[model samples]
Target: MIDPFGGIKGKELTNTSGFFVDKEEAIKEVNVSIGILENKNIKKPTFLETLRSKKSKNTEIHNNVWDYVPNTNNEYVNIHIFWSKKVVRSKNGVPIRALKVALVGLKAFYRQINTLKPDLQHPDILECYKLSLENYQNLPPIESFISSEKQDLLLDPFAGVTGVDIYKKYNDLKKDKDLTLEEVKYSINFIDQLELPKSKRDKKFITKKPKFVTFTFPTSESYLNVHLWWAGQIIQTRKNIEIGRTRLALASISKFIENIDVETPDLEIEEIKEMYEITKVKHEPGKLKTSRIELKPISKGGLSYWSTKTHRWITGKYDAKNKIFNPPKQNL
Candidate 1:
């Protein structure tokens, strides 16, 4: 029987896993990412690259937006875009290509169409058109930026911390005629209203992966244990004292973990005393690469090391709790 008086607890949204694709396979990979949406040739590219670069000096694959050659009998259009990020470094004066790398994230969406000025009026390009740039961010948009189509079932695979999913990569290309999102609204619109937070089972990556416990502590004076989660559960522990500077604080924390009991009723117990050390890079994202970590167990002396690209040290602890949560405080 369940205890009706134990007050149900909720977990933070940051514990989910996220999915992403890099520049090279931007189009194809995004199409094959998770679900299949409407697939078609790009209609009109709000921002177009007028210049083309050669394969030797630059590997820009142009001509994704094909022009219908009026041969009186046939009209064929080919759709395949291959633009290189390296093409930005321009060659001397002769003007090799028009480089407009917008911060809008051109790689995220692939619906493009080039409706040139009716083949009649000849107008010069605007000055602002020549002054746009691209901005690369570390996260994706999970809150403010929304999609329009209402999926039958919505899944927020990764939680709140992502931020790069909003802006389009029109690279310096502005809404000269007030286009892009508005036009996209009619074509492949986004669906933001359908986001459902209650359906999440693991509180992170909207998947059915086995819940792993989280055990967090203050890496500093302000790191909060509240913003962290694991296996979709709240973190409850005895000590949330700050871990201080990672380099010097390791010794004391290691000693603490080596001598703690985690099977108690506290929610944050199982994170101490690891069979394998949880190594971390001084302060860099994905720098430690833990998947390749291997430890040699000698009846437990102190710690172990990953024998590869990283020479950093990390310690892992374990307990009998259902899940662990060791979150650092959310910076104010």
Candidate 2:
């Protein structure tokens, strides 16, 4: 494998100045410094250990490491040192030791990169250090890295709305053309009552369910059909209402549903009945025709492109495609 941080020479690796031309050299210096400290029986401080020292106002021992690493004019170098000291003084997890090690390494790396000859300096050198340090500081708790078999369990006693309910409600509403706004509101409430799944670990905890419940459908057409059906029901409640007025009402209701924390008994009902009429007319049987068309590939440079002519229905047979059937279009 290629070393992303160009490999360093033996002389550069052992250089006591702690400066380096690139990241690889900087990292090597950090590791060597950490090793030297360890060899002298100096134990690296843990996150908790440093936290207790700071709370007690005894951070002198922690500051001793700064005396060994050379300070530099580079902003990233100074910032890394500041963060490293802060991490040692406060922060959590085993990664704090890793951060301290990285800070030691960066001190040498930044020193070299900052002092490099104008032509030798890489544009991304400073950016690489900045991003690396940022990512390191944002590291999550170590336990998050561990895999667990635990899965979320549905807290609700009922199985919640399924595809069966979708079709059943659709068919029932189709037969009963007189759908009241109260009935539509009741259906929305029924769906909202369905609780979201909770983790098994949080079984005992009580939490409020989300305002909306996402119902899954077998197909995209079915999802739209269901929402359109509900839209139609809202439309039915008002007779002789203009399509534009009904559309505005439905839009208002949809917006209102999104913002409310709880359902209101006196919630206003709006219109969408005109949309149902338009959709019903467009989807009428025999209005659309389905036919297969040949799609030939274009040739280039005297080479005939290879493509097989496959038969596919490009339009209209709703029943053949297993889609919802629309009402017959009537002459205006």
| lDDT, candidates in the order shown | 0.24, 0.30
- Per residue, candidate 1 scores C-alpha lDDT tens digits across 158-192 of 11112221222221111211232232221111111
Give all TM-scores, in the order shown: 0.18, 0.15
The residue-by-residue lDDT of candidate 2 on 156-257, one tens digit each, is: 111121111111232222332223334434433333222334332233222422121222443321121123234233332333333223323333344333
Q: RMSD for all candidates, in order, please.
A: 26.2, 28.0
The deviation in Å at residue 233 for candidate 2 is: 12
On the 0 to 100 scale, the lDDT of residue 17 in model 1 is: 12
The per-prediction tally of clashing pairs is 53, 3
What lDDT does model 1 reach? 0.24
Query: Alpha-carbon error at 120 in model 2, in Å?
Result: 75
